[model samples]
Target: MTLAALAEQVGVAVVNLSVMKNDRARAVRFSTLTALCDALDCTPGDLFSVVDP
Candidate 1:
């Protein structure tokens, strides 16, 4: 699905979703994360990863 479509499904603006897509977001609310997971039918583990920095 397109970002715009996903944004609509998740009840967020396209620009906000774009920030998350680009890894520019500093934080994400649990509600928003849940919405994304529900829309994509995926787990949080599928969407994020941990890295040594």
Candidate 2:
């Protein structure tokens, strides 16, 4: 899904979504995480993967 579309659906900025995509997001509220998962038709694990940072 397009970041723009997701941002619009979640009422957030595209740049913020980009930050999350880049794994530079400092924090994410549970509500936002839930919304993201629902919008993307994915689980939280799909939105964020664990790896060496």
Candidate 3:
């Protein structure tokens, strides 16, 4: 699915989803994360990784 479609499914703004997609997001809400996971049908572990900063 496209970013716009994912954003619509997750009930979040495209800009916000874009920020997460681009790794520019400083934070994410649990509810939003849940929505994303539900839409994508994946676990949180699948969506995130420990980045060596």
- Choose the strongest candidate by lDDT: 3
* Off by more than 4 A, model 1: none
Q: RMSD in angstroms, candidate 2?
A: 1.2
Judge candidate 3 at residue 31 and give its lDDT: 99
Q: After superposing candidate 3, which stretches have Cα over 4 Å from the reference?
A: none
Which runs in model 2 stand beyond 4 Å of their true positions? none
- Can you write out model 2's per-residue Cα lDDT over 1-53, one digit (the tens) per residue? 69999998987899989998887899998988888888878899887777885
Clash pairs of candidate 1? none
The Cα local distance difference test for each model comes to 0.93, 0.87, 0.94
Candidate 1, residue 52: how far the Cα is off, in Å: 1.0
> How big is the positional error of residue 30 in model 1, measured in Å on the Cα after superposition?
0.2
List, residue by residue over 1-53, the lDDT tens digit for candidate 3.
99999999999999999999899999999999999999999999998899787
Residue-by-residue lDDT tens digits, candidate 1, 1-53? 99999999999999999998998998989999999999999998888888898
Clashes in predicted model 3: 0
Whole-model alpha-carbon lDDT for candidate 3:
0.94
lDDT of 2 at 20: 89
